[model samples]
Target: MRTDRTARTDRTAPVDRTVATAVAAAAAIACLGTLSACGPDNGGDQNAAPGKAASPAATSPAGGTGAGAPQPSAGAAKPSAAGSASAAGTRDIPAGAWIDPRSIPLDATYHWPAPAGAAKSVAGAPTFKLQELCHSKLSPDTADLGTGRAAAQSLAGAGGPDRWQAQQTLLYEGDPRPSSGVAQSAHAVFSDLREEVKACAKTAPGATVKVTGPENADYFAATVTVPQAGGNAVTLHEYLTAPDGTVNELAVWTTGKSGAQPRVPWVGPADADVAKAMDSALCTTLKDC
Candidate 1:
């Protein structure tokens, strides 16, 4: 996450504590349900895979993020047939409501859920970003940028536990800092970021987080949907900024789809407690980064 507070809403913005609190509650409930439903997929383990853990991508000497650009489409979406596209005021897109960050492999095939809302966006097109939404409830509103939750280490050593066998992860051997810490500012920053994300999700239909480009910069986002918004399939993006402030690695995900898709929000809102825990974890792990 950019240490820049300027990219976020002001503390004095129209905050509705009560409403936000309620949404936070819903978010917690949703997490429980989701955990129960997806527990199997979580592998119940977080150990690094056997062999050397993948190193975060290296930063370019030019100080530019080296993320590869999105592949271009053959041509503009063919104009809809006279009667195929719904008239204005429609709520969602046609059958494939999902959004594939236009960066799919040329030979890849993607599938998206049928759009359920109106034929078109009521307010505007979805803002597909690629921040870490793994730890947030309000969906893609917030990021998991090298904050919150220390990267776990194996007692045996790098990839010692094997991500398949242990719930703990392997930290970069070259990096000395533990994934967690005992700092207050980090915790405070995490709490603040979570709160802001929760508030933003209220109005946003859905959001996405992406690693800021390929290599450098504090962290960047895809304000508007573009072919460059990669990892739309899994709808998950992880940005790893080197301690030196350069984003060295980024991961992206989204439900595979040819065009836009639907956001399967958690059953309830994201849990407020998660924010507290995440804040503490992040603060504790990365005090100064």
Candidate 2:
């Protein structure tokens, strides 16, 4: 396949422009995406005096909601619709939407944000966040896109004996806007990233960037390399949009420096795998795609 490569200087501008807008929109869907926290312990007596000995009565109150009292049956608690939806896992993903996971590399261990430790390894250095690979720019301000917890997913793999590491993820932003608005918003983000890639080509001096387009007529791929003192890393980013304004992104990057074998082999999915994932019914909400 043909790969369009270039170098660019400015990369953070596109990210800054949309962060404020996207974060603002984040408030709207925060509840939907946020995870539940562990509730505080109820073992302590609320009315106990500091440094005071607890009276026998305080230790065990009759008919109180304490551990000593007869506990309420688990059946008494109510289940929330949101909790149920998240547990279902298929909330946005339609049946048979994903390519057979078997087709992906056998060693690829699917992780939500790659391995957590990978991020902490390169402190005080020019390390890249996984978000940067997918979210280059924010969706349109007026676009009602939902960035729910269930809306994002990722996978990581240890490259086979090559010390290469690969990671891929998808961001499903559900847009509640009308067709005109949804189309405009999706196109806006895509155009923004395209322009950013082009702009980067001219500025990054020695860095190498290859941009390829309209994959399956629905996706775009960009490969970037930023040269540094010791060695540089290569990152492959893929972007896709569904008819219902759901945006899917896929990325795989090397963990090792340029010219050296990677320590962890990347077993993440390939461009074709990413395309298959986007084609699946990811984020197919009721009455939406």
Worst 10 residues of 2 by lDDT: 61-70
Model 2: CA > 4 A from native? 1-83, 86-155, 158-172, 175-179, 202-205, 214-216, 237-239, 259-273, 283-289
Tens-digit lDDT string for candidate 1 (1-289): 6545654655534476767888999999999988986585664433332111222212101000011000011222221121134332221122221112122111123221111111121111111122233222322432222222112211111121111110111111112232232223223333333343334333333443332332333332221222323533233323222232111222223343325453432121122222222223222332223
**TM-score of every model versus the real structure:** 0.20, 0.44
Please list the C-alpha lDDT of all candidates, in the order they appear.
0.26, 0.36
Tell me the tens digit of each residue's lDDT in model 2 across 226-259. Answer: 4444555544443444444434444455544666
Scored by lDDT, model 2 comes in at: 0.36
Which regions in candidate 1 have their CA more than 4 angstroms from the true location?
Answer: 1-217, 222-238, 244-252, 263-283, 286-288
Top candidate on TM-score is 2
Q: Looking at candidate 1, what is the lDDT of residue 96?
A: 23
